[model samples]
Target: MGRTTWFDDDGLKKGEWTAEEDRMLVAYINEYGLGDWRAMPKRAGLQRCGKSCRLRWLNYLRPGIKRGKFTPQEEEDIIKFHSLLGNRWAAIAKQMPNRTDNDIKNHWNSCLKKRLFRSGIDPVTHEPVVNVKATSSSTMSSPTLTPSSSTTDSSTSSARLLNRLAAGISSRKHGLDRIKNMILSEPRQAVKEDKLMISSKEDEEEEVNGCFMEIDDNLISTTSLDELLCEPYDMYQSDLGHEIDDQLDLFLEIHSLGQDLS
Candidate 1:
């Protein structure tokens, strides 16, 4: 047998498919039924690559294909599956019987992503966006005074410190929430460090105050609190000392102001 013409060597047509091309593709598929994609375009007498022909038919010309807007349920399903499956568009498409991967992917990029972002949800991670700047600035710049060493101390001192720092600053609530969320979102090691810092009364008051002083020194020396938080910290060290001190000072100032008013 002579060499079979598998595909046309001519430059394949691209961009918008003509009305005539659609009819040709539809007619070819109707009569012959779908076959090998690589040879389909050549056999159908279309100046298109097999891949292009395949996409056109599957995404547009296929029987029972839904071409209108997706339903609300479909939209919810897309978001739900996207959260679980990430950008596996084809896998997400399969969950909706009548949808195509291209349609779902387009919808996500064009509409869903913006919608989620505006709602304060990270569309990719499907989680609330931590306002790191707000948290870092509020915590780093404002120093709160700790109660005098004579005041009651307990294993829960760290927790008390956070509460005191947040006290009397109604506007700082958002920043405090962001910090709590960040701590919760951190790995188990960070969680453990948080507990240790809160519970560790092993150090003498002098040692603890010395450490606080060192952190204050660093905060005074550094220009950017954001950079400091992002830097690597030793597993044993709590990186939030300066922030705590700032909050502590603010707390004490607020208390003294209340006393002065009284």
Candidate 2:
């Protein structure tokens, strides 16, 4: 069946309605109740179309219609509901008792949508917008340093080991930055990835320490008692060498216990 046209052949009134037209619409609805809107203008002596009349009555002249600015709670709920339901304004209106779908939609487009964008949030997805450039720049600026050359001398090797330790700290800092980006961009995935990264790093540390323990035990056990006694006196000659000896001792002690367990 063809849909009945509510608009008149000569075109019904299109602009702002007069006070008399408002009164007539209210009077007609009150006396006869809201019947078929298509035939309403003719019966009520109104020049407006059925759609216009319906909108005017529902949005403006309807009882209990809160016409003022929306409250903070209503604004919050609209954003929350819109995130869950998308553009289902009618469904959103159901939760807001005094609001219409049109008002809710207008408020979102005019206000909430822009607000979300400004706050780095994707209105459609309701997720934080990741700044790719920021992440890239941060990572590029903090390049991980590597040992420039290899040497068999114990002093040079110790210096390289210290450099590698510093590099490891830098790598962990980068890892933390990536985690921060993930959290902002995708929270649920970030949580899972965070757990996995922590566990993997822990396991890596254990394996690395196991290897270090074996190396440390071999180095300590192979050294002559005379070298051990002389090394401390040699370390005392310079502050830098003293620091190196102290660090090496601490590192070996920590890993030596791990060797016993193996």
Candidate 3:
């Protein structure tokens, strides 16, 4: 919308109003009440348009209008409403007590939009941004799951919706598994390629069987570390069977590579 004309070639007062103007508008409304906005300015003794007078009364001079910073709960409600109702500011205002449509719209535009963006969310769609800090396609962006994951729209049947939801999750999980398998398919090579050159310098200083041994003593002490291990977290180093270990390695590889899971 273009800037609201305070005056249209008719020389009627436009733009910002004076203290006396507000006083006159408020006084007139207090006495006659709000009805005919086109005639209100004339009766209110103001040179402004009826639209201006009405807006000033309702948005500012009106009683019960919320002023100052929005509370946490109010901000949350605004976000929720925006996500569901889009940019329908008046509709969002109905959900919030004392908050006018203009105020909510202003707040969303000035504050919430920036806040959402900084938190890695697209304020318009209200979805998590996917590796968005990078501007180029070659930046290796990760995919983010969003409400659009489902194939069906809002008009879809319950069974179709459920199937789409299941399908979306399955597709994501399968993609992750494929990447994982690719990395861990050469489990031996991956382990072998990790060129960590440990030597006798790392041997534990302990008297084993009353004899101060070296590498053998280190091996004996290494076995004790396995007792400290637990499932999932320690799975890589623990004695999961060959097949289970391979799967676990695959999962960890995918996870380490930053493949998103739904």
On TM-score, the candidate that comes out on top is 3
Candidate-wise lDDT, in order:
0.52, 0.53, 0.51
Per-residue lDDT of candidate 2, residues 1-262 (tens digit):
2234354567687667777989999999999999799999889998878988999898888888787698898888987666544565765676686998888989999999889867766554354544422223343443211112212233323332332222222234334244234334543332222110011222333222222322344333344334543544354335233333433454455334334433
Estimate, for each residue in 171-200, the C-alpha lDDT of model 3 and write its tens digit: 333344543453345433332232111112
RMSD of each: 20.7, 24.5, 22.6
TM-scores, in order shown?
A: 0.48, 0.48, 0.51
| Residue-level error in angstroms, candidate 2, position 68 | 1.5
- Residues 117-206 of candidate 1 have per-residue lDDT tens digits of 677665644545444222233434432222224222232233323332332122233343443343345423331221111111232222
Candidate 3: where is the Cα deviation over 4 Å? 1-8, 133-262
Instruction: Report the alpha-carbon TM-score of model 3 versus the true structure.
Output: 0.51
Candidate number with the higher TM-score (2 or 3): 3
Give the local distance difference test score of model 2: 0.53
